[model samples]
Target: MWPTVSPQSRSSPSADGAAILRLEQLTRTFAVGDQFVRALDGVDLQVAAGEYISLMGPSGSGKSTLLNILGLLDRPTSGEYWLAGEQTSTMSDDRLADTRQREIGFVFQFFHLIHRMTAVENVELPMMLAGVPPAERRARAREVLQRMGLEARINHRSSQLSGGERQRVAIARAVVMQPKILLADEPTGNLDSVSGGEVIRIVEALHEEGLTLIVVTHDQALGSRAHRRLLMRDGRIVQDVSG
Candidate 1:
């Protein structure tokens, strides 16, 4: 049985006063050759606005699968998912895409910056895709990149930046849209200790600024820093703890 978590565990005062996300009997399965693999098994969860959570487990523990679903990158095989009081399971593809772009900010483990684009341009891509005016996109991109400490690197290509700088660029790109929820998957996995520490600090700072943060990682130190921690095993969330 999964451990109990009180609704008050959310703790943070949210502007919306409703859970940012709610999952009911969430599950994801894949057919691997002749075998059917269950990536997530009957998982249920609730995430309030401004909460910081860490999901930790060994490989194949469903952490990444959960993140993918939360980020709207993948649909659950069968279950209900609610985002900001809207039921997502029944949303059309275009609607889903629109909701994702407007509500979710994803920071991938590997910096997925376009190699040929400059840092500011990379950060502007989301706004462009969302049909924001070109002028507004450029202005917002510059503002977010500057906030991320990338003002001087704004014109640098991804290949020209250091690992830490690249990661910051990716983060800037993720938040450029001002999404309410930030889903980070192994955010510090590819960086050296110092760089990873800096990245984590920035992420935590965002949490302090009231972005609902959920992180999937194998690093114990980073995971432990979250106000709530979940441990998964074999497609199930075996433990959920909150302070």
Candidate 2:
């Protein structure tokens, strides 16, 4: 469930009256040899449960940095990040890893599949890491792959699949853990239009099912499909549109 916020808080109320994510003056800086570079600068944003958000900007605009931070793969140099109303910036590494595995699902431009593993095996990887029973993992993996329309290719290795098939497999792997939030970074970047459309349809289906979905993409058509569109420049959100 999302957390209820007081009207006094800087974060605006979500349409659903609860916020799943809130960022308070979020900042992330990095060292570049003798100089420091700011990747994210005082970003304040809020996302409601089941909201479909698209982040768009030119390269180097901190889109990936923000996504990385939101996914708990990276830490902010300063500021607070709240997930379901819990501040997480100061969490220990072990706790953060645990939180990420249980709450966040990520899909990337490149399908990061283990080349030697079959599609079902790749989908089972997350559950395996979480120590689920082998029989349960196999059943859940088969279910997800079938839902992704990869039932025929379930036993095929990544090297034997087409680009689209590889991506579907990747998506299956990401969601097999059943996370609350799905963060997709260029999910359709490598596919042709037909393949890309299929991927988008699958992703939108997930959003419709009540997963808070955030996607970073340069494709205008894809971005426009989101419920809210956020434009970023120079590490800050320049525009936010919702309809």
Candidate 3:
């Protein structure tokens, strides 16, 4: 049986109306030889729906680990994780897999598109997995691609697109499922300033549409754009501030 989280517990207000994610003393550790390396140290964070937050840090500061945990690609070694009002810390792999597919959108520095797949097919990947019909997938993929300014690139293979085009396609795919949260890791790391800003626009548009968004990057300029910023180093947050 699933554990119950009362509706009232889900109603915490953060000026944005509703809390979307909560991390309580979240910690992650890895063993290396005789040493135990702490990747995250007692991190506590709360992200509200429609909020845009950023994580900035030096390399090895646990930003990547935090992003992976949020995206369900990795689990914390210790601490509680509440996502969309559900406790995910104890969920089985199957449950966790389902949660990720249904609730989270992910963008990464590499774009991570299949080089051989056309833009539309990549955009339709999630819908296809959820058993959405081919016709619906096609319609949704086309709709989202058009919104991302990739209508004409629908049939182009990833290799045929420029870096910006590819990342835009990636963003289109990530949000096609209407995920409750979008997690981006260094979304603009590989693009030039112009291309970077374009990606930021796309993310901001999503935020405007009421999605909870978190960006993890090393770029201070990019992090500053978020309403809330967390600065980290050597696996722990050194500072957390909001504007």
Candidate 4:
């Protein structure tokens, strides 16, 4: 069984009974040779704050494309993306970058920690980039790393840590900013069962604390854990189920 995490250890709930994300007639296309490939076909979605959702589909299903758009890493070829009640389509590049940094946290299958940086340093990068003072960012990094059960390894570089520890550090970095939404793409795809389970529990604990969680995965068991499940096919949301 997974250990329960105290709410006080994590960021406070930010849900205010509103939709945190909304997409209308969203479409993304890529030019392939002489043809346009539609990655997202008129997709429409509304995600309430604090909701836990899982997106599942086959390889060509546009899960990654949609995740990219939601993360603000990519823009839809057509349609509007409203985040926290603001239409992001018209935002300037700087504004979009700021919004992405402030409102979204992402965890990927591969731990993206810098090999030369210590756990704390890796966790501090985002805050540092955002012009946070050294003292404050260091304190925040240490706190989140401690919560990740990496206090002893905080000074260890990514190269010196195990896969699980590295991933934990990545997670610490992702959440240190206390983003409103956590977007995870195959978060456990690279870990062993034990480590993966630990990662899952950690994220679930964060969700319990009211951070909106959206995960994209091919694993049925993992995808089923969410309160809401979405199935995508041919760049469209074919099914949405809630229980």
Residue by residue across 130-239, what tens digits does model 2's lDDT show?
99999999999998899999999999999999999999999888888878789999999999999999999998887766677899999999999998999999999999
- Which has the higher lDDT value, candidate number 1 or candidate number 3? 1
TM-score result, candidate 1: 0.93
| Candidate 4 residue pairs that clash | none
Q: What TM-scores do the predictions have?
A: 0.93, 0.94, 0.92, 0.93
Q: What number of clashing residue pairs does each candidate have, in the order they appear?
A: 0, 0, 0, 0
lDDT of 3 at 189: 98
Q: In candidate 1, what residue range of length 10 has the lowest lDDT sum? A: 1-10
Q: State the lDDT of candidate 4 residue by residue for 133-204, as single tens digits.
A: 999999989989988999999999999999888888988888988888889999988999899899999898
- Each model's lDDT comes to 0.88, 0.89, 0.86, 0.89
Runs in model 2 lying further than 4 Å from the true structure: 1-16
Error of 1 at 61 (Å): 0.7
lDDT of 1: 0.88
Residue 85 of model 3, lDDT score = 88
Best by TM-score: 2
Better of 1 and 3 by TM-score: 1
lDDT of 2 at 230: 98
